[model samples]
Structures are given as structure tokens and as C-alpha cells.
Target: MLAELIRRDVDDIVDEWEQFARSSIPAAEDLSPEDLRDHARLLLLAVAADLETVQGEAEQHEKSRGELPDNSPQITATAHEHAQHRFEQRFTLDQMLSEVRALRASVLRRWVEQNDRYDPDAVAELIRYGEAMDQALTESVAFFGAKVDQSRGLLLGVLGHDIRTPLGAVRMSAQLLERTKGLDERQSKAVQRILSSSDSMRSMVDELLDFTQTSLGMRLPISRVPSDLGSVCAEVLAELEALHPERDISLACEGDLSGQWDAGRVGQMLSNLVSNAIQHGNELPVTVTARAGAGDVSIAVHNKGRPVRPQSLATLFEPLAQAKDMGGDRHSGSSGLGLGLYIARQIAVAHGGSLEVVSSEQDGTTFTARLRR
Candidate 1:
């Protein structure tokens, strides 16, 4: 009966709902009256349809918890679609949820105010209407959360793709400066800095793309090429040394060190680990040990300093995970994005390998990566 009551006075309910949206949600500041009203109208209609259906007591109990699998999909589909559209409109989850509650409340208040004669069946009707409204809200929340994730993935994908063009141009300009005949030593060194910065930017952009792809439910793509593991680690270490000339970094290799892997990705992993060591353990020499086993290869970067906190260690390989003041400053002077270890671990996993860490006051921090050769 309330569902029918709602259908009869839907226009007045929508007006009241829009008034609440305008006053409550800051994201609605720039939206027109229609935009501010958002999905509440369709959702209210969906809720009305759901209430009109004849649900048995068993199904009613299921509906109360939003678990009416048989009927919910068809009943709540419009609400879910409205949720996705609202996400693109920049409505916060809480704001959207609030509007749903307002719509339900407005409908009930109207029904109670308009009718003087109250029937015993009105109570049952109210309960059913409430359950259906809640079910629709649940569906909307689910779709809203998914849309948030998708939007983030798309943003990262676009950002990483768009930033590379300027980076490549800067690198080329730096290279051209290096070839200038009248350049002094200072000018050449500055050019090298620009070139080095370009390399760092490119690496970051690549990591961002990888992060975005993975967040979008894709694996980190890698191309396997014939390569020497020793050569890969060696070049990575050389770059670190060139970047941090004052720091002492020692690399020790044992057994055969050649393998078939993505040389660039492996180098990226090594660079992330070694750079982490030097930045965290600058007071002491950073040690890198590489070994090629019968069927696998292992590389670990060791440094002595303060141990990583237990809480920080748990999420160390998590993307954007950073410890307070832990990422202090890098030798390259660029602030870390907190994705280095995360992307490194992803690369390792992509290559059928694993990356882990051990840290203590006594033994220090050691990041080890083991890969199938």
C-alpha cells in the first residue's frame, strides 16, 4: 500500500529529496537542480516496484538482509545503474547513501500525513517497503564502490601515458646539450643531471603504468629475453654508484650468473632494493649478494641501520605504503612515491619469483629476490 502511496506522490517526494541533496552534499555545489536530485527518483521507483512484488515470508527475510538472490537483480538493476552514473558525477558514497535514506523517510512521512484512517495492514506494508528500499541501497553501494575503483584505474592509466611525452623530449634536449661544443664542465654536468632525471621519470612512469594495469585486474606484463643475471645486477649497481658516488656499495656474485629473464624488469627490481638500502642504511656500507643456483637465481641487498617497524614491514610491499619519516630523502634527492618495493615485488612475481624482506636491530634489513632461471 505504501509502494502505491509512493507512486501517487512521487513528484512531491522527489522535490523534498532534491532539497536535502542541495543542502547536505558539498559535491553538489556546482550541480543544477536536476543533477543535484541525481538517482533518487529512479531508485525510489525501483524500490516501489520491489515492494509491489508478492514476496513470501522466507523471501521477505532474505530481502531484509539484501540477499534475495532470485528477485534482487531485476528489482535493483536500475538503482545500481544510477549508482554508477552518480560516481562519474563525483557524488561521495556517504552522500549517495544519505539521499537514499532521505527518499525513504520522505515517502513514509508523506503517507502518514496524508491518510487519516490507518489500517492494520499498513504496518506490514511499511515493513516490506523498508526492506525493499534497503535492498536497493545495498545494490547501489556495491556498484558505487566498483565505479570508484574503475575511475582510479583509468586515471592512473591516463596519467602514466600522458607524462611520458614531455619526459622523452627533456631527455633528448639533455642529450643535445651534451653534444654542444661550447659547453663547459658545469654545463655538461647539468645536462647529465637532466638526463638522469629523465631516466628516473621514465622509471616512475613505467611503475605507475604497471600499478595501474594490475589495479585494473591485469598482470604486470614482461618480455623474457636472453640475458646475463650478473650483467643485469652489475649495470644496476653501476648506476647506483654513479648516482651516489660517496656511498659504499659492494656487490658479490657466486656461481654462473646468466639466465633467461626480463633484463629490464630484473634491473628495476635490483635498483629498487639497492636504492632502498642506501637510503635507509646510509651510515653503513650497502652489500649486494647475487648467486645462481642449479635452477634458480637469488639476489639480496643488505644494509645495517634501524630495523623496519613490524607494522610497516607487514605492508612494505603494498603500493603507496610508506612509513613516516622512513622515506626521509634519497641520494638522487627525489622523493620516493612509495611504489618502488611494491612494483619490484610485482615484477618478481611476474617472473615466477618472490621478493621478501627481513629486518632486525642485530642483523639489519635484507631484501631477497629469488627467480626461476
Candidate 2:
């Protein structure tokens, strides 16, 4: 009975929905009837299937909010396809919402007109219809938002990569200016400032690139070769100390430090963790320790400072989860985008390794990366 009703009313529901779609979404104005009605038939059929399903009130409550993740992939997949098409067709969230609202109202209007008078069970059917609609709408919204985020991430990745060529040229010109003849002391300081600012810009660009690549379902690229992990950490530390000589950073390497891993990526991760330590730690010396045992290598960056709150430990590795004011260490190269630890963790994941952290008042905080050698 439910399926028959949907089969009877699907065209009307779609026509009414398309009118709302066209008015609300400029892109939908150009969509053909096939495109505008994309998946509407399947969506209505899925709702009809749900109405026929024998589900308890408890299950209904859970499913209404799209909480029954294991119930029906067919239904969810249909909704996801609908959302993907809408996203590709450039329908905004608002327009999509409007279309769904119009669909429900149209279906209700048809149901009312069909019986000529309201059935006593109309309220019960209405509740089940709303639940099914909610599930489909939730699935659609989730898919739509994911597609939108991926597009944004891809755009940022391309933008960040393109910005680097010009930035490198600027850095090269700044270096040449530093070596210019007949430069006064004031002129030299100005050149130094320009160099510093350019380096900061370069770091920001690199972070943005890393963030976007990871967000867009791509890993940061790395080239693996025989490299000494100890030397890599030392080289990274030397560069960091030059930028932050006032702070104390020491490296301790033990056992075999040579490995077949991406030296540049390792250095990048080490640099990020150490920089994070310096920024969040107190005026104490930050320590980086690398050790190789058997077929495993571990690197730990340690600092004695305030402990990361327990609540924050869960989300600390998430991109941009840290506060801006908590960062901004002059040499940290973090414009408070909070991507350092996130990028570092991703580098470890790409290397088939893992990044872990332990923080406490007594022991301070430590970020450790374990890699298989």
C-alpha cells in the first residue's frame, strides 16, 4: 500500500520539489528534468520500503536521526547518490533543504487528497514518514557536506602549491639583497627582516599545502633513501636553534640511527614536534630523543611545562585544534593554524608508523613517533 502510494505520487512530489529547487538554486535552473529529478524515484521508493519495514519504536527513534548505521545500505546508498548528484549540480545546502521540505509537503498533500478524509492512522503514518525522511535527509546532508569539504581541500592544495614558486623567487631575491655591496647597517637589518618575513611566508605556504593534501585524501609525498635519523634530527635542530638560539634544544641518539626512510619528511616531522614543544613548553630545555632497537625506531620530543588537559588530549592531533594565542612562538612557524602536529602525525601514518602523545603534570608532555625499520 505504501509503495503504491509513493508510485502514484512520486512525479507530483518531484515536480513540486523542482520548482523550489529552481527558485532557490541558480544552478538548478539549467538542470534538465532528468537531472532535477535525479534519484527522486529511488528516494521515494526507499521511504516506502522503510514504511513497510517492521521496526520497533526504539529502532524507529534511532533510525529517524540516521543512527541505525547497519540497517540498510541500499536506502543509505540511494540517499547518498542523490546528495552526490545535488552537490555536483551545485545545489547549496539551503536549496537542498528547501527541496526536501517541498517533497514532504507535496507527499502529505497527496496523501490527504487521496483518502478524501483523514484516516485515524494518519498520524502514525505521518510519524513513520517523517522518521524515514529524516534518515534520508541526514544521509544526504552528510554526503553533501563531505563532497563540499573535499572540493575546498583540493582547491587549497592547488592554491598552496602554486604559491610556492613565487615565494621561492622572493626568498632568493631577499638573499641576494642581503649580499648586496655598499649596504649600510640599517639597510642590512631591513634586508634581514625581509628575509625573516619571507621565510615565515614560506612556512605558512608549506603548512597549507600539507594540510590540504592530507584533507583531500592524499598523503604528503616523501622519497625514501638510506639516511641517518640522528643526523636528520641534528640538522633540523641546528636550523631551529639558529632561528631560536635563546632557547635550549638538545638531541640524544642511541643504537642504530641509520634507516631507509624519507629524510626530508622525518626532518619535517621532527621540526614540527620540536617547534610545538618550544611553543607550548615553559622556558625549559626541550629534548628530542631518537632510538633504534631491533627493527623499530622511536623518536620522542619532550618538554617540561604545563600538561595538556585530559579533555584536549583526544583532539590535540586534529588539524587547527589548538588556540592561536597558545601558539605564535616567534620561531614556531605556526601562524596558529595548528597543523604542525597534525602534519607530523600524518607523516608517521604514511610511513606505516604511529604518533602517540603522553601528557601529565608530573612528567610533562611527550609526542612519540614509532616507525618500523
TM-score of each: 0.82, 0.85
Give the C-alpha miss distance for residue 195 in model 1, angstroms: 2.4
Predicted candidate 2 versus true structure: per-residue lDDT over 1-373, tens digit per residue: 5457887777877878777777877878998988888687678878888777787878877876667886666678988988888888777887887777778888877787777655656667778888777777888899999999998988988898898899889889989998889999999999898889888888888888889888878877878899889989999999999988889999999999887899889888999999888888877899999999788799999998788878777788888776443333544456677788899999998888999999888998899998776
Sequence-dependent TM-score of model 2: 0.85
lDDT of 1 by residue, 27-54 (tens): 7768887766546666677777777777
RMSD per model, one decimal: 3.7, 3.2
Candidate 2 residue 105 C-alpha distance from true site, Å: 2.6
Model 1, C-alpha of 262: deviation from truth (Å): 0.6
> What range of 10 consecutive residues in model 2 has the weakest lDDT sum?
323-332
Q: lDDT score of model 1?
A: 0.82
lDDT of 2 at 116: 61
What TM-score quantifies how close candidate 1 is to the native fold?
A: 0.82
